[model samples]
Target: MEEAEAEEQQRFSHRQRLKAAVHYTVGCLCQEVALDKQVQFSKQTIAAISEVTFRQCENFAKDLEMFARHAKRSTVTTEDVKLLARRSNSLLKYITEKNEEIAQLNLERKAKKKRKPEDENRDFMELDADVVGSDS
Candidate 1:
């Protein structure tokens, strides 16, 4: 029982570590400017916690480093972070627009279907009434 409990705990720890790594990596990639300058974490520190492949992380780090070098800026700012965070809302906006368009199309299709049946029925009823009057 004790061995089983220990194994469970170890598994839980590993999961937690992986979760932390993924969170940190995503945050770093998404907020490169804000973290690179304002945050005081070493590259090794970032690497230790990230689950991302070495190449991906390396590329991300390189881009930020290059930005910093080119801009002659010593610190990453909130503005830098802003660049990454800007993408957060556009995806939701796109989904909402698509949903609205689909709803409109569905409504138009239903209206058209209803009208076709009603128009045909009205014409058929008129023809039947004319035949009855003439026969009488």
Candidate 2:
């Protein structure tokens, strides 16, 4: 169908754009000076860097998918990501810190929501209704 073809084209275009962005970022970083000396990367070096980075990203994605599937999960969780980063101690540590930070933030937000003025008003209204009904 034309719709399927269009969707496939869009996906291909999106992938190409992502690859180009990766290439550009790698090129920019490669040009940065190191140890007071300017650095330069040949086209082949840039291409190789981009290729390896992209391949790793793809492998990570697949691993995440498999991890989720193995757990019968429809969506990936932080545990899955942490497992994926198990090969790198620093990365795993960083991910654990971030996960804890986010968890703390979520708990604070939930507590704030539960303490809203409207919640107090609703409870008072319910209590008042029960008292009035009993009197009647």
* Total clashing pairs for each candidate: 2, 0
Candidate 2, residue 132: how far the Cα is off, in Å: 20
Model 1 clashing residue pairs (backbone): 21-49, 37-76
Query: Residue 20 lDDT in model 1?
Result: 73
Collision pairs in model 2: none
**Best candidate (score: lDDT):** 2
Worst 10 residues of 1 by lDDT: 77-86
Query: Which runs in model 1 stand beyond 4 Å of their true positions?
Result: 1-87, 133-136
lDDT of each: 0.70, 0.92
Off by over 4 Å in 2: 33-37, 118-136
Residue 108 Cα positional deviation in candidate 2, in Å, after optimal superposition: 1.3
lDDT digits (tens) for residues 1-136 of candidate 1: 9999999999999878766777676566746765666756556655654645645555656766666766799775434444433566875566566767878999999999999999999999999999999999
CA error at residue 68 for candidate 2, angstroms: 0.2
lDDT of 2 by residue, 1-136 (tens): 9999999999999999999999998877777743237556789998999989988998999999999999999899999999999999999999999999999999999998978978899899999999999999
* Global Cα lDDT for candidate 1: 0.70
